[model samples]
Target: MSHDFDLNSPENIADPYPSYARLRTEAPIYHSADPDLWIISRYDDVRAVLRDPDRFSSDVGGLESDPFNPGLEMPRWLTGLLSRISAVRVLLTSDPPDHTILRRKVSRAFTPRRMAAWEPRIREVTTRLVDDMLAADHPADLVHDLAAPLPTTVIAELLGVPTERNDDFKRWSDNLINGLLTGGPRIPMVRSAIAISWFFLRTIRRRRRDPGEDLISLLITGEGDEALSQWELITFCILLLAAGLETTTNLIANAMLAIFDRPVLRQQLCANPELAAAVVAETLRFDNPAQGLMRVTRTEVTLSDITIPAGAYVIPLIGSANRDPDRWADPDEFLLHRPNLGEHLAFGSGIHYCIGNALARIEATAALEEIARRLPDMAPAGTPTRITSPVLRGLRSQPITFTRTKIPAR
Candidate 1:
């Protein structure tokens, strides 16, 4: 198997499926010497790594290291500052015991009943955003106007943050995600993290004085000794904000792009609006928002006849695994009603599976349903711009045009 895979290459970034397919078939476990990382592309291999965390640990500090400064050769003061700001021990980066406890405490806030209750608000928000887009102009950038803001607003409401401050939240999330994705600069990323930390700290203090029916309050007042510390609470808040906003934003935008690419499918979805959920599922399988995640080998591990030394970085290619030929009949094609769509490793597997999976699905389903119902004839007005990052896969801007639907009297 050839080891020339370069994740940062322009060609690969633009369309990774081709490279992923070759890797899956030729080298399910390939090592790249340039970055000193192992790539796992097979569905079973990726699933196994995620499930057996005992062998493949999630405590890889590289997950949070600055992609720009991987060597940690910065000045002592700067390195210390980065460490302080970036040392977030959230569910995504913790192992069992700690992960189990954090997950249990956080699960209390995302009950099925609560998610069901959020559906109406999600629909209302979607309708309003689409209404604004319809009123303004044709060729509106849906990514910015709708797909992006909707999730930020939803997560803000869930976190009990003031809706009026949603723009601020969006800025913070964009800065953090862009920094992590492109390794643009260290200062802005550190500053954004610090600012978000201070905001959450203040919010936590306020919630202590005046408790509210929100996630912050739930984390603050846990059962027995399971409550989170101030730092943990702050880290958890930032984690929820970043994860909930970025993933769902990408899901909605990516689903829109995929559906619009196939006019027949788009029309079919519009005619039968209930199939919106199928669109979401198919999108997750075909073009997952999170392309892959990094996990380290806790001990020597053998995958696909390749022996990976202990303490080595392993990347599970979720996007590639979702489209593995062995896993699906027509792996690359977007079939809305694919029976195995739910089996994709999009939300990951095992205990580390996305806690906000339900929320993301609900939000995406609402967005798709509203778009199909209101803008049944929506069409792409220009080429969609894709976000270029090895880890995050999504559209940065999608210009779309549609006939304005009249809003009925209240």
Candidate 2:
């Protein structure tokens, strides 16, 4: 299919669903130059790429430029440095035995028992955030006050960081994550990465010497066949902090962003707080936090008669797949009560599925239920702004107002 598909265009970044619709219909396995990638947009095709890790390798690093914007390509040495960070090849970026070992080393931290133990604290944090938002007279920004802080606090607590250092941790995560979406070694990101890496290394070393009952301590204290190296621990901390903070924040903010404009939906949520889970499920399908993830072809692979060469970058558009007409009834509409809603690829699939998804769900569900319970009449005070990244998707700011004001809880 000869079509003009620019994955990084500002229009696509702002709202890529239209272009996604076109891709799924006309070219299921479309390839584009500039930022050269084999874009897989169909539900089944994207699922296949995700399921078969052997043929589609996840050991992707050395990304030179914004896969969406080729103009921002970095210098050769800069790209080489960025590639080393990518080359760490642990967890999501690593494949097979390495990934298996790394995942196993840290999997205990996210056990159902641990999460259930953490639920009360999650609710406590959520209620405090919502209360503070409600107590304020002027409109509150969900992204800043509630959504961001809730996850940031929980993840910090999980990692055994002092709550006083949450802002520092968040700033560090923000810079690194923004750079990740852009790719390569931008000078600012490089500097920030160095600072963040140094911070993590120092913290890891300290925790290893004096281990605590935190996830970082758990990763650092591994002393058997699956023991993670120092660098691996550093990488794990970075991934856990970045993923846990941003994704849950995005999930809560995105769900509320959708509900803010739709009064009926808001009313429904207020009417039945149990529907908060349903709201979360639909938001993930409608406007997920991440649109796509990159994978390299282990060998030449074919989908829809299009042969992708070995080592080529394959992008499975999760947002596009979630909206595929073949898989969804009204692919465009953000309707709740979706029967097959649980099947969406927002959390991804297979070995690399989001390790923090269970936590994200717990956080978002708690945030939503509390928001619905507390600010039943919350409405948009101004336009909500979305984060501008080719890979990540969520609101950067969500200003909102509510009719009822409750006394702030201590």
Candidate 3:
């Protein structure tokens, strides 16, 4: 079986699912090019590793054995420079008890009550964004008009950043995240680290002076040692910005593409607003924002009769898992009526499940529903440009031409 995976290749980055399917069937655990990291494409194997973090460590040293470690790709001096900031603020990169503490501390801020209370605000924001897009002209690129700003605005609101400065925050957040996803030298990464640290420290100082009703302010006064450490504060802020920005950004873009791919489904969705959630879930499964994640083994483990040595890098193909034959029925097809849609690992599983899953769902649902309702005539304006990054999958720009709808007067 062919094992070469040119992650940089435009073809692979744009639609690697077909390749992933081939690998999952022919080589469940195989090494790929560029550091020859071992990837687990089968749902069972990937799930096992994700669930057992003890055996498959999430630590950096563990990453040394992985094929795609930046440190391995960088010069010694550059690697040393990048090592200054190794702390992971969010739950995704941590493991076990520590992960539990940090997650619990922030989980309070994501309660059902909190989400429900924000529904009206979400709807208002969605409506305002749709109105703005209409003003821009019908068939606007969803990425720039709706998907990008919606989450950034929400994240800024959460962090207590003044709405006036939200634009700057969004720019900085995009730079920081793009740096991480696109493999490269450590300079951009270092700069991102500095920007994040500065942003959080400044925010913390302000919150101390005059606390507000926001996540950052609550974080400033939250009880217990689990209160985000200074380092965690910076990483968390960056995490919030990046996760909030990219995940939903790709989701909305990918959802739009999926709808456009199948005009029948698009028509069905445009006709019914309530089916948005189901459509969103199917979209997630169909073309997830995140493509894959890396894991390092702490000890030798057996997956699918293959013995992976301790410290080997494991790539969990999320795209493959969503379409795993052992899991979903008619794995290749998109079925809105599919039962147990929530079981899909689009947000992942175990301790590292996405912290922003609910928020992402809300954003996708709101954006898609509003678009379907307000701009039923919307269609792809031109060839969409997919972003180049193995970790993220979505259009960098999706130009669309559509018949503009007039907003009703207040």
Candidate 4:
């Protein structure tokens, strides 16, 4: 079959399933000439690429252009600034030894214990946000009111970001992620990256002088060469803001949309709060927040009857893989009770698998439980807006409405 897939097209961005289905069947290892990237769409094929990191390396340093093709032409100075920012390699882009070291240092602070400890606080924050929405008016936007802020607030606290600078962190995160998803003018993205790097560097310096019980302080106080460098610390903070904030934000929003779209499913979840966890898992498979991720081939490799030359870009379409017919019975349907949800590549697989998966799940479960219990009757008040980025699948704004429950007198 002819390969005519356009990854950046609006039709694919709004609804990529049909395209993904066609690609998976016709050209599972199709190469797109426009982007000059190889696309892998089958579930097993995607899993194979993700697990075999040695062949499909994450270290895309020598690539001629940004794998996602942000489409920005920057002044040389801004380009240099972005280069300096990129130099502080985080786990997402690093492979093997470097990834291992960086992961260890960050893991010291981002422990399972710490994440478990945040559960109550996550619930408290969610309840408060729902309370605020309940008090304000009907037709509240779940994205802004709850989904966006909950993870940002929780992550800000974990990272020890000062309450006053929360807005800056969110703004910087949005700018960086937007630049990544849909490359626009280079200046704004470059400026935001520079500003955020400076902000994090300043915070790191403060943590050095006066260490506290936060992730940044932990990284600052860690010992040995394995410990994160000042620049690495700053970059990790930026990574955390993006990973922790954006992904979880979308998970909640996507889960809500899935539940609301199915009245019976919504009622079932509202009736049995335990089902909320299942709903989250199904959403991760049905409409994963991250649509795909890029990896560069270290050497010539053949996958699914096609030989991709060395240094070529290969993208594992996570969204498509999740719905692969061979893996999932009703690949496109949202099945809350679907078994073996652990099989989904939503958080990816292999060494580069998302480290914050646990935290994201906890935050999402808590948010969904709160919404199901409190806003059970909530329905879309207006057309939900989608984030028009090829790599990110999420709502830009999801306005919803329900009968406002009266706040009991304090």
Candidate 5:
């Protein structure tokens, strides 16, 4: 397959959805120019593959990636770390039995009842943040002031990390996530990972000595806590922090961007309180924060008339699938009244459906509601700066101007 698709190009990073759509329509499952993997787009194909762990694999080591191919010029330390840590992390990057086990352990901390318990706290924090933003100035960067902090705060509280430690968490997550790009001991990435890893190790040990109601503490004191080895605990905490912070942060930013981009839809959302869920669902479909996830085929299998060999890499384009024209009507248009919004693959589907979905939804919804209530006339002040990662889609900065300089405290 000789074609043009630049994964690292600045243009693609800024807006890959157009390319994803073209791929989905022309070749739903086709070999990439790199020839190392088979890229899968379209809603049915990606969702079906993600749903079946039997045919597809999520094992980090089993993944058919060559972040360190023979002549790639990749960083040595980064490759080494990738080869080592890939197999040790939590359920997100693992498969069946192990995935099930780790997910079960952490699942207790985020049950439906627990999510209900978190609602009040989420609202309180959101309101307080909005109050502070309003007090600061009218022309505020919503991405910095509202979108970023809300998720970070919620994730920190959930993990029992102190509010003061949020900067450390953000810094570490940014480095670690971006590190995956340069191939292993990417200095900043490794340093940040080591720092966070050490912090989690110390915190887990403290929890073991003096347990609390937080998720980390629960992981240390859960029913399977006795069976969990030390490495598992540390890896689990690291995975939690990575997903907990990054996913929700992007979700807020992406949702806000989608709403604000369409003035009519924004007006509808601001006017209709009951239709918030629909708006959120449409936002997820329109510009999903989690653009895609990589999977490996365990055996030679056929998907959508394309043959993928065993050990072949599979990139499921979530953002593309959410907008697949076959599955959605007027897929490109942002409609808050869209009926099939829940079917979107924003939180993913099947076993790997985000464990933090409820929390993310709560945090995102709170942000939108608060923004509508406090800064109804907030408008983008400049072109938003997008985060440069194919896997995670979001803005690095979004400057905005609100209607009033002084926001009321409700």
Candidate 6:
């Protein structure tokens, strides 16, 4: 407890589970000094913060999170303008009625039936991607060939946008996500955000005239009550694009990495490909993609009898919460059949649960199953790179070699 719980420390970023264990034991409501925030590492306490947005308003609190604007260097005027906006601008940075309305507008995006409609597309993309990856089989970078593009491609198709523009999406997505995670230059990501927003605005206008089955068109055609204003529509589209891409990309990459050094686990998955879901589930728990989400405290609050002052920043670490010793046995191990797996906060909980949860599950599952079947001997080719982030965790590049097997027909 005497040592600082440095969330972004090199050691913590390398392997936060140990520090997280110490946090849960020594300071359940630990506060970090560098960025000035309180961290809630225990499961019950984290769940309480996420589900209770009243005392911890995501609107004002969420704005300070400044996730999109890395280093949070916003002009005074822009910060002032955010309040007068018609609705909360972004889903990830909004709370209550506004957040509620925004989320509800696109809630049906990944429904069971809708997912069934897209299941074939998911499999097709996964198969084709895997085939393409295996064709270049010797020491392929899974992050490049497969994980990075699959979700973005599906999202593009889902939005009725052209996949040929994927290069632009990739560039924009990288700048935006990297900016937030790494505290890198904000100008590039801001430019990327503008470019993507402009693209979505034009697409939304087009969809209004000629509706299609894609998510954007569906949102365009949404009736009263669920109708999205121009601002809301643009924000929602950006959220879907960013969230859909990064979360699943990281999930698949992390899941594959979990089994990378463990040959027994890889071979186990090879024999029982159906355990793909379990692999994804345990990866989420073992190394969830979304490491932490920020919230600002509206009023004073207490956890484990420790007080968090009003207007303070709070981070309920999803990565830390899942691995809290109080919650699971052998908390660090990546067991595919960990009981009560759904309890993990990978997709989060309450009204803000990820809209793409089912899509991520199925997409990652499909990716895993096909890889197991085709590249059953997949192994790490070299040192895999970890993303240097306190809030997101996954490999940036993973060199993997695998046996060439005939691509299976769906």
- Model 3 misplacement above 4 A: 61-90, 137-139, 183-193, 407-410
In order of lDDT, best first, we have 4, 1, 2, 6, 3, 5
**For model 6, how does the per-residue alpha-carbon lDDT over 292-390 read when each residue is reduced to its tens digit?**
877788889987799999998888888988998788888888877777888999888777888788888889999999888887887788888887777
Taking all chains together, each candidate's TM-score versus the true structure is 0.92, 0.91, 0.91, 0.92, 0.89, 0.92
- Model 5 whole-model lDDT (C-alpha atoms): 0.75
> Each candidate: what lDDT?
0.81, 0.80, 0.75, 0.81, 0.75, 0.79
The local lDDT score (0 to 100) that residue 286 gets in candidate 1 is: 92
Clashes of each: 0, 0, 2, 1, 5, 0
List ranges where model 2 is wrong by over 4 Å: 69-88, 182-188, 407-410
With a 3 Å backbone cut-off (N, CA, C), the pairs that clash in candidate 4 are: 70-183
> What is candidate 3's TM-score against the reference?
0.91
lDDT of 6: 0.79
lDDT of 4: 0.81
Model 2, span 1-410: residue lDDT tens? 56578876779878999999989988889988756789999999999999999999886766655565455555223224533764464577778877887788878777878887888999999998887776667768889888888987888889888767677877777766556554434676667667777887887889878988887887766557556677777767777765677778888888987887688898888889889988898999999988898888989998888899998999999999999999999988889888898889998999988888778888899988987777777777888787667667887887877766673433
Checking candidate 5 for backbone clashes, the offending pairs are 77-184, 77-185, 78-184, 78-185, 79-184
> Could you tell me the lDDT of residue 348 within candidate 6?
82
Which digits, one per residue and each the tens of the lDDT, describe model 1 over residues 185-282? 55776678788888899999999999898888878996686678787788777777667777898999889888878989988998898999999999
- Candidate 4 lDDT over 224-342, as tens digits, reads 76568887777677777766677898999999888877988987998887787888888999999999988889999988788999988899999999999999998888886777778
Model 4 ranges off by over 4 Å? 62-87, 137-139, 183-186, 407-410
